[model samples]
Target: MKFEKNTALDFVLNDLFEHYRQHVVAVDRITSALLEAGVVASQADIVNDHIAFRTLGVAHMGIASFEKIFLAHGYRKMDHYHFAAKKLNAYWFKPPSPNYPRIFVSELIVSELSDAAKGVIHRYTDAIVADPVDSLNLGDGQQIADFLQRPLWELPTSQDYNKLLEESEYAAWVIFNRYYLNHYTISIHELKEGYNTLEEFNAFVEGLGIKLNTAGGKIKTSGDRLLRQSSTVSAWNNALFADGITLQIAGSYVEFAERSVLPEFRNIPKSQLSPQQRRDGFEADNADKIFESTYTAQIKDKG
Candidate 1:
């Protein structure tokens, strides 16, 4: 935990993350399962590498609107990344101290998508004539917590949902689950024997019958190879549409990240290394497939 000692801010972030875990059913399930299976003794021993969020790339919403909550809590925005294939622009923010998890927020470029995809997204977001986050009080932890799960628009029709899914699984996901927590990563490198590295952890997880996103490969590695990541294919939940029709839709999943020693820090013992000596931020190519952790191609395999 690199978080600076700030009780007030720590409480607020914990409250928000707790609220999120309650809604993201997979979080509770996976964590419990891991503990029950004796992978780790307790939750405190594991570190959350980071958490992710997806946003619509339209007016009155997006990284611009969403980042305020974290920035207000002492997070400083770090690297900016572009995803040409997914039409996303993202940035990762570091915590004031090592205790808090890093934050990654990405917004879709709706204008770059096709008219059909645009129309489906607009149906939900066009109603937000004003930037809602602007009117909210960031100091109020509960308010910010509610805002994360609040529905910005009415539920989309199954048809529109499918249309967006066809064009962009990310679009379909954000449309139904607005401002939802995409996934929280497990810092696998910090774990004990048989789970310290991604390869071992991945094998151990598969032995438990959990499916992983194999889009590029079971492991998505940085070009520098200091950061390796993988995730369970997001579990499908039955979405209750406005029309009362129930259909299985992809929900959030758990991610595993193993950050290796940086080249310059090779001589130092990992325990004695500084935070900067570790792989600091994300890699675009690796994330490209990690993003597919919730796509139709990936979800179909889960089903």
Candidate 2:
């Protein structure tokens, strides 16, 4: 269904926001931190601005929230598909934008299977496939290890398990510039010129009050002549948050709220719309504007 920009924005602000309240708090905290740092100007607003305008830390927090919301609805990461794609692409790519991670909720038949039996595998082939996500039935002795494996599977048999996995609908949401930090190489020359060693640079980043999963203790530099790389390896811990899920790929955390349907949409006075409408409206408008600007620049160059 084609929703107006206001309608879509309202859905995100009202529906998605209430549905993921705790997650929003994490996002807000990250945004606040970025503002405190020189990474983002204090006047900038997170909910109504492009994520690219925010710091790497803030962007990761938003992406983490996106993952958790879908996962709470019984979705699982399609690691193979997600990693293989050059960019994050959501299943629902049209109205809401598709530059985020796509997740799938399984519709497997868990009942007749043995204890070690792998449940059915349902893949969300597209964002707007249908009410329920697509399913590939798996019987006993299937040995579909990777797809069915989840922390939830260890739970004792109950209707709750079936309700969690079976009666859920899945949709893919995209996080734009998911690999921003990993993509562009920060010039080591710049770091060396400013600081004597990688530790000094790390200290600077930490001084910004940004927490790093520094379990690896120190950054490691690859000896490659053409491609110099340095990284602080750590797991993204989500244990502190209500949701136990963490991003294993990168060291980051996301806070997630318990799943529930959104409350009824409230009517706003036309005057009240001035602020939120202007803020969210600008984001909706400028998204296309930026794309157009980029396209125009490319076209002029070609001409």
Candidate 3:
């Protein structure tokens, strides 16, 4: 846990964002486009609704280990969600203050995976039998900062990656891109112009030649219609494997979100729909589709 009384909440977020954008290339392109779209007055005006991370359910890692950092910073765990088809368990946290972004973490259920897939995954993850994060000084800013981007295992061969890709795309992704920031969602309702609603904003994104996840039809709305969300397909990157081979795989991407006023608050003026008035939790049906953003649509092993 962070020991300092004045640990500077903003400093932690700023540090995370700086490191995040460096690896998630979509952040740069989309933020720039948002500014150009006049949806925001400036880069500073853009609001991140949340950021998501993917993890494995094996020992020494997963949500239990990752949530400690946030809990230390005053964030509280909120809703818990499970995706049976995806074989994942996840939870979203609310920041101590409204200024910080929410955190969504999902861990794959390794025990449910095919033995072949599990074996290939453990071949690499076994390198860190102990949770590396547990050894770090919780009070150290640099150590907490490094945890997010640090590599936990050696690269797998292209063949193993392809095999994992066949059974569980999430396993392939986590194995190749460990603990990387998966995607950051923009609060489109907070925008000033061109992309205010998820619908229009999605059209605007497609206009820029960015592809959206159509698994559940570009716009995934909550059953109550209080939350609307959309995201671009992940960018493909050429990754090097342990066997001296390179393969193009899906990387991180950007997400757009618009939270309509809850039905109970519908009568209130638009200005009255404050941060809390708008829906604050995620939709399992919506997230189930959003998770597919990381899968290569072709399904064939391009490698």
> lDDT tens string, model 2, 13-63?
233223222332333454455456544453222222111111111222223
TM-score of each: 0.92, 0.27, 0.91
Instruction: Provide the overall lDDT of each model, using Cα atoms, as 2-decimal numbers.
Output: 0.82, 0.25, 0.81
Q: Is candidate 1 or candidate 2 better by TM-score?
A: 1
CA lDDT for candidate 2? 0.25
For model 2, give the 10-residue run with minimal summed lDDT.
168-177
Clash counts for all predictions:
8, 5, 0
Off by over 4 Å in 2: 1-5, 13-21, 24-26, 38-117, 120-130, 133-205, 208-303
Off by over 4 Å in 3: 1-9, 298-303
| 4-64 per-residue lDDT for model 3 (tens digits) | 2256455556666776678767677777887676656555677889989999998888898
In model 1, the clashing pairs are 1-98, 1-99, 2-97, 2-98, 2-99, 3-97, 3-98, 3-99
Q: lDDT per residue, candidate 1, 1-303, as tens digits? A: 222324556655566566667766656666676798787776666688998999988998899988888888789999999999899999999988786789999989999999978987887888999888888888776687677778899988888888898888888899898887888888887776777888888887777678889988999988888999999888778899887788899888889999988887899976786666788899988888999998878877743
**Which candidate tops lDDT?**
1
